[model samples]
Target: MYWTERILSEAETRNSGTESLSEGMRVIIGGATYTFSEGILRQERLCREEQEQTKEAFGFKWKKRDTYESPSVKRAHREWLLKRYFGGESSEIASLLHGRENFLDAGCGSGFSSLLLFGDHLASVRYLGVDISNAVDVAQQRFAEKGLPAEFLQADLTDLPFRGPVFDVIFSEGVLHHTNSTENAVSYLAGLLRRGGMFLFYVYNKKGPVREFVDDYVRDHIRSMSDQEAWDALMPLTRLGAALGRLQVEVNVPEALPFLGIPKGRIDIQRLFYWYVMKAYYRPDWTDEEMNHVNFDWYRPSNCWRQTPEDVTRWCAEVGLRIRKMDVEDAGITVVAEKV
Candidate 1:
C-alpha cells in the first residue's frame, strides 16, 4: 500500500480528513492542517529543555547532508553494523529482517546510517523512521532521492504516536543515550515491539574517570556555543587526533590498570587517547569536515549518556527482552535482543 493510506490506517486515532497534496498528503488533526510531505509526517512534541537542545544540535549536524556519506565511511559503518548486530555476515541481514511486517528506525537521523545498514532490505518490510529533530525531513528527502519508499515522523522518544506492540523489528543506533533518560527510552521502545520481535541498538559505554572528565569538560564549554561555533571550536581536538594518528605510535602496557580500566595490551597511541582520554575521532583517509562531524556529534549534544554493559543487560531483562547477541567495544555497546 502507499504510505499515505498506510499512515491513516495504522494511526492509533482517526483523523478528520486527508487530502492528496503535491508533495505527499495532508491530514487534519484538531483543526490543524499537518502535511505529510515527501513521506515525512510533522508532529508537535512536548520536549524537555535538554531534549530540545539535543534536537536542535542534531538537526544542525545532519543538515550537512553529504559530509559523512563517503564510500569508505559507509563501508565502515556497514561492516560494524553487520558485525555487531548481525553476527558478522551481510547475508544474515536478510534472514533477520525479511518477512518482518513493521520496522522502526527509532531516532533515525537523515536516514543515513539506516540507509547504510538496511538499504538493501528496506523493500522487504514496512519501514518507519522517527526522529525528534528536523532530520526527519532530510531522511525523507534522502530516501526519496534514492527511490526508496519510507514513512517518517517527527516525534520525541518520550511521546511516540504509535500503539504498543506495533512493530516487528526496531533499530536504534547510537541514539538512546541522547534522550532524556536512556533507561526510559529503552523500555518505552521495547514496549512497542511485538512478541519475538527484535530490538537492535547501540549506546555509549561508560568510560574511565579521566576520559569522562575530559568529555564533560569539552561539553561544558561547547554546550552554550552555537552549532557553527561549537563545530569550529572542536577542530583543534580533531587535529590532535589526526596528529596522534599520524605518529603511528603504539604503547605497551605491561600491567593492567584496573583502577583506570586500562587492560594490559599493545595499544595504538591514538586509540589510547580516543578511547581513554577524550574523543578525538581520527581516520586518516577522512576529510577534515568528516572528522569534525564526529567530534561535534560527541560533544555538541547536551544529553549524551554513558552506561555499563550490566546496565544494558538489566534494562533488557526489565523490559522483557532477552539478549540474542551483544558486542562490547571501547567506543560503546551494541545489542541485538528479542522480546520474550
Candidate 2:
C-alpha cells in the first residue's frame, strides 16, 4: 500500500482503540494538539525523539545563543554560510525570490536558519517554520520574543498539512537526508511550491567508501548511547578534527578521480584529510561547545543518507523542478531548484 494510505489506515485503527494510542502521546506545546494522520503521528514520535536527543546532545544555551546575538553577527554568519555553501553566485538564490512573498522553512531547527536568512526582512514577508519536534516550540518562542511576524507549526515533512502550490519559496537545509525516504520527502515538498517558486536545500553528498565506512562504524556503535555517553565517545573525533585543522598542511594530487569527486589540483591538507580521510575536523573559530554540537549532529542521528549530484539532479527532474543551482561541497550537495 502507499505510505500515506497505510498511515491513514493506522490512524483509523488507532482511533478505533485496537492499540493503545495513549502510549504514543507527546508533550503538548502551546496548549495545541497538532495531530494529523496516524502515519504523521508515528513520524512525529520519531522526530520528537531524535530532536530531543539533539537538544540534549547540544544543550539549550548553545542552540539559542545565535538567535539572540547582535544583528551584525547574525548577518555576518548568514553571508558566510551563503558564500560557503552557494559560492560567489550566492545572491542568485535570493534574487530568484525577488517579488515572491510566502515562504516555508521545512525542518527549521531552533529558527536559526530562518533568522539568519530572512530575519532582516521579517516585516515584509510572511514566513512559516515547521518541524516535527518540540523544536518548533523553541522557534516560536524565540521569534515571538524578538517580535518577528512568523508562524511555527509542528508538522511532519512527509505529510505536511499545507495545501499544494501555496508557497513561493521553501528552504530546507541539512534536513531531508534524515527522513524515512529522502526521495519521497522531496517529491512531497516539491508539490507545495507555487509555479516559479524556489526550493533550496542542503543534503549529504556521497562520500567515498573509506569515509562512509568510518561514519557508519562510529554511528552504529553510538546509536543506542545515552546523550552524555554519546558526547563522551565522540569527543575524541572532534578533537582530532581540531588538531588536523591546526596542521596547516597542503598537498598536490596528480589525477582526477571522477567517482570520488576529486579533481587533480593542489588542495589544503586539512581540508583533504577531513573530506577524504576523517570527517572530524572542527572550525578554528568555533568554541568547544559549538564543536561538540557538530560532532553530536554527525554521530547521533539514526538516518544519514548521502546522495550524489546525479541523484539530486534526477530527483529534481522527476518532481518537475528545474535545477537552478547545484553546489557540491565536502559536507553535502546544496541545491536551489525552481518549479518548472
Candidate 3:
C-alpha cells in the first residue's frame, strides 16, 4: 500500500470512536502528498523551546550528513548496532526485522542509521521515519535517491500522532536521552507497541561523578551557542582527544577507586580522561571533522540525559515492556525488549 493510505488507515484505527479527522484532507510534505489531520498539525506545533534547540543542533549535524555515510563509518556503526542490539549476527537481525509489518525509526536523523542497520530489509516492512528536526527532509531525499520506499514525518516523540499499540517494531538509537525526559519518551513509545512487538533503543549511561560534572558544565557553556559556533568551539576538544590518542600510552591502575567509578585494569590515557573527566571523542583513523562530529553530538545538545542500568530496567517495566536483552558499555546502555 502507498504511504498515505497506510498512515491514514492507522490513524483511522486510532481515532475510531471519535469523529474522523478531516477525511479527504491532503497535504504535501517533502514533495510527497500525505493524508493529514488537524490533530497532527496541532501536535506538531506543541514543541518546547529546548526541543527546538535540540532540533537545531541535530539539524546542523545531520545536514552535514555526508560525513556519516562513508563506507568505513557506516561499517563501524552497523557492526556496533548488530553486536550491541541484535546478538552480533546478520541472520539474527534479519529474523527480528524481515517479517515485521510496521517498523518505526524513532528519532531517525537523516535516515542513515536505519539504512546502516536494516536498509536491506526495508522492502519487507512499512518503514516510517520520525524526527523533530528538518532532517526528515534530508531523510526523505536520501531514501528517494536510493529508490527506497519510506515515509518521513517531523514530529515530537513526546506527543506523537498515532495511538495505541500501532507499531510492530520501534528502533531508537541514542535519541531518547535528547528529549525532555528520557523516561517519559520511553513510556510513550513503548505504549505505541503492539503486544509481543519489540522496542530497541540505546541511551547514554550515567558516567562517573567527575565526568558527569564536566559534561554538564560544558553543556551549560555551549547551550547558548549557534550551531556553527558550537561546532567550531568543539574542534579544540576533538583535537585534544586526537593528540592524546596518538600518544599511544597506557596506564595500569593498581587499585579500583570505587568513589570515582574507576576500575583497576590497564587503560589508555585518552580513554581514562574521556571516561573520568570530559568527553573528547577520539578515533585515530577518522578525520578531525569526523571526531569533532562525535564531540559536538555529546556536548552541544541541551537535553542529553544519562541513566543508570536500574533506571533503564525500571522505565521499561513501567511501560509494560519485558527486557529480552541488554548490553552495557562505558558509552551507554543498549536494550532489546518486548511489550508484554
lDDT (CA) per prediction: 0.84, 0.68, 0.82
Q: Which candidate ranks first by lDDT, i.e. highest? A: 1
RMSD list, candidates in order: 2.6, 7.3, 4.8
Model 2: colliding residue pairs: 241-281
TM-score of 3: 0.89
Cα lDDT of model 1 by residue, 132-240, tens digit = 8999888888888998878887877656655568889999999999998999999999999999899999999999888999999999998888999999999998999
> What TM-score, computed on C-alpha atoms, does each candidate reach?
0.92, 0.77, 0.89
TM-score of 1: 0.92
Query: What would the C-alpha RMSD of candidate 1 be, to one decimal place?
Result: 2.6
List, residue by residue over 182-280, the lDDT tens digit for candidate 3. 999999999889998999999999999999999999889988889999999989998998999999899999999989999999999999999999899
Give the Cα-based TM-score of candidate 2 against the true structure.
0.77
Q: Show how many residue pairs clash in every candidate, following the order shown.
A: 0, 1, 0
Candidate with best TM-score: 1
* Cα-based lDDT at residue 34, candidate 2: 36
